[model samples]
Target chain A: MPAIVTTGITKSFGAGETRTSVLRGVDFEAEAGEMTFLVGPSGCGKTTFISILSALLSADGGALSVFGTEPNRLKSGDLVRFRRDMVGFVFQQFNLLPALDAAENVAVPLIIQGVSPRKARQRACAWLELLGLGAHLGKLPSELSGGQQQRVAIARALIHEPRLLVCDEPTASLDAETGRQVIELLREVSLNPERAAIIVTHDDRIYPYADRIAFMADGRLTHVERPDPARIPARPIRGETQP
Target chain B: MLGIALKMLFGDIVKMLGLVMGIAFSTLLMAQQGGFFIGLISRAANTVTEAQGVAIWVMDPKTETAEGPTAMRDVELYRVRGVEGVRQASPLVQATTTLRTPQGRSSAAAFLGVDDASLLGINPRFVVGSPEDLRRPDAIALDQLGFSRLWPGEPLATGKEIEVNDRRATVVAITEALPGFTAPVIVYTRLSQALSYVPGGRNRLSFILVEAEPGRDPRAIAQAISAQTGLLALTTPEFQRRTIDYVLNNTGIAPSFGVVIALGAVVGILVTGLTFTLFVNDNLKQFAVLKAMGLSNWRLLGMVLAQALVVAFIGYAIGLWIASGFFDAVNQPFSDLKGFWLPWQIAVMVAGATAVIVSLASLIAIRRVLRLDPATVFRG
Candidate 1:
């Protein structure tokens, strides 16, 4: 079974004369152990679709299931719990809380899950170290570079060890080299046989890092593209990659 | 989540301090103005407090305050003295007259008349001379406060004669007494001497100060005095309330102080409320992110309330400290602001106002955070 499956998911905004549809019958699936990329131009409903899959937004119409549970059918409170316990999100702007140091920011998900703060910080420290941010754990978001900030956001997303990790243009803020380093880091640290990573991006530079890329337009999935077999990495990356 | 809320609130040092200052000023305004009002009104009961030996105060039905007591028939004292629990009932005279110093500077002075033999209504600690000295010709025992007004910066030495209502009045002794509301300096004299100074009819007795026998309830004795003499009677506490009530209802004092106290609360609420709302609106995106992170609207509301609570707690403590210090600075017994105290009610008032200001100020923020679009995090 796919980690996330959406059939005929529809969403719209506004009302009356100004009403506009954003998503029209988009069917998508993200597979476990693979980093699936949902790539589209601005206003293509990529965020909305991933938001539905993450249980952050309810689709106006759909049959949506995240890890065999239909998020659309869950109660509002249970939907929040589903999002908190089963999914993690990485935003495009690297939305780390400016007040907290990297370790505290990464510990947010665990704290929300009722983990003791000391244990949460320890787990956050381990994850931050895994993402090559061990030395920067005490630095605030403003004190770090954009690349370091994005790594912190990634660490926050992965800290709770959710089955499905969702990224909204996670590398959108980084430079060419930094974006490559972040995508490679995500591929190495997040994806496994039991857990999956889904990224929404239009950055052609990071396309090779994704196992598959879904292209969208006008709120509908156009097609999915895969890398040439010869260009694929010989094996998955498991540890730190120097930028 | 609570930790995150706290971090977010304190992260912006300037904003947090601004919020705390707003709350603190509000608390200070309410507490301090209320203290002054409390201090001012409590002065109306100065004479009642000065008469320590009197447990029950008997006056005419028309009399509302000690300062405005109408003279009752002298025979009324005999009726009050006849009451069952009354150990003694003294005919007390209270009148305000002008005291002309030797230098020709004249100021209003209150004269308290007591029974010469018993000295029931005019008990005070003597600074110079003795109570018996008042029996001398035209002699008066002046309060230390009155002594200062009569002869400014003069020592407590006796034989300082001053004109009372254009007649010779000698300051035979100096007695330290908290100044009365009508005048800072009060003259303690015999009942006949007080009656001679003020022009009046046969009924010159202002009050019949009664003492309840040992172990007797003053409230019951007061009731018996009123029923027997057909006069209004009140225990000390009840008389104090009557005095305060008279000031509140008849004079411009209540409205004057009420406006200031109410204005302080209004301005505090507006300022703190606006600042709190502005702070939340400025960080709308952060709330959106939290919402996107699956925080419930209830949790979001709790976060804003928590921020409000921190501000209220810090502000109230600091504001009350300053208000208490203000009271300390103005509490001069020799001056007119005697008997001024910040009661616990004022603290409760400040705390109650703080809670209200916090809740009102955070209402908009709470509503906005509750309705925030979690999808807004996707924009920009």
Candidate 2:
């Protein structure tokens, strides 16, 4: 089974006279061990599509199945548990809780998964170390540079070893060099045979790192492509489960 | 989670400080008013309470203690002794006498005249002179407080002469500090000397004091006395209640304290509610962040309620401290006003009231937090 499948998903904001459709008949899928990219200009519904895939927004019309379970069919509490257990999200703005230190921010996913704080901190520290952020674990988000904050966000996304990682413009706020480093980290995380990542980005500089790239126009995906193998290096999967 | 709640509660020191002060002031006012009211009520009954071994007080049916004079026949003393529980009974005369003093003929003095045998019912702690001193035909025991007013600069020596009812009487001994209704008191001879001062014949007395058998209920003995003699017999509590009822019905004290107590309660509820409301509003963003982190609505509410509890407890402590200082500095002089005495139960009640007020104030903010869309954090 695919890591994520959405058939004929549609969404609209407001109601009646003021209703405006933001997504229409969007069908998408991401395979295991693949780094799929959704590239589009501003206001093209790339972020909205990722939101639905991450279970943060409910599609008005769709069959959304992540890891063979329908997200919309779950109750409120169960939906939260499902999202915490099955998905990790990295946003464009690096939405780290400002009051928490870097390690605490990275531990949030594990906290949501009901891990004890001590165990969660240990796991988060390991991820931060893997992401080259070991020295900055004790600093707060405000104290870190943009590049360091993005790395912390990336560490948080992969801390719980979620089956599917949904990232919305994960590298948009970083410089080209820092953005490339972040993309490479995401690419390495997606090398697991049973885990996948769907990243939404407007920046074209990081497209070479994507295993498969899907282009979106307006509210629809218009094309898909495989990046040149020479431009991307093979990476060893460090934290994936064997299936 | 509770630790998180405490951190949230104390994180904003300014708002927390405001809430503490508000609650503290309310509690302090409540404790002060309640204590003073009780102390004032106790003063009206002190005269009767100090008289020991008197189980039943016989007063006229139409008379209430402290309201007006109650006259009973001196002959009723014999009838009261005829009851089963009654061991002895005595006729006592209470009259207000004017004494010529350095303070321009001092105000009316509470004069008690009792037979030599019944004088033991008076305060045993009489300072300098014994009750036997009042047995002398021309002698009287003056209260210690009375001498300061009567003599002013003169020393309170034994056998100092004072004019009572324009008749010269020697102060045989000075009694301890026993203040009476309206002013300090003097104890004089009961049989012939006391009756001669009254306008009527010596056969008339103010009231009869009845002593009952050991282990007898005062109320029951009072009923027995009232049944045999056609008079109203009252226990100590009943007498006190009658006096309090008379004062409340006849004086302005009830209305004044009643209004103050009511205002205090209203201000307490409003101030606490408003303070807590502003506190919650200020933390709305923090609440939204917590809600977005998958915290249930009930957990968030618990945190807010915990904050309120901490504020109330701290406030109550400070308020009590302030009230005690006020009482020590002011209230004890005019009346026998005592310090604030708060029981554990009363503290719990105050805390419960504070919690209720805080919970109501938090409802609006809690609803807002629960309804917050987690997606907003992503929007900006």
Could you say which candidate leads in DockQ? Answer: 1
Steric clash pairs (candidate 1): B146-B185
Candidate 2 per-residue lDDT over residues B1-380, each given as its tens digit: 45456655676677788878777777776667765665565556666766767777887776677325577776777888788888778777777777764335564577766765666346666667777777776777776666766665566666877667767667877766345545444454554566665456544677777787898887998987788787899987788788777777777876787677557656766877787778777666556544544555666677777777787778878877776666667542122232224445545655565566556655666676677665554564
Q: List the candidate 2 regions with Cα displacement exceeding 4 Å.
A: A32-51, A89-158, A164-236, A240-243, B48-50, B65-69, B90-116, B120-207, B245-271, B324-336, B343-345
Q: Name every residue pair that clashes in candidate 2.
A: B24-B315, B127-B176
Full-model lDDT for every candidate: 0.83, 0.71
RMSD of each: 2.6, 5.2
lDDT, candidate 1, at B157 = 76
Q: Output the number of the TM-score-best candidate.
A: 1
Error of 2 at B80 (Å): 2.5
Worst 10 residues of 2 chain B by lDDT: B331-340
What's the TM-score of each model vs. the native?
0.93, 0.78
**Predicted structure 2, TM vs. truth:** 0.78
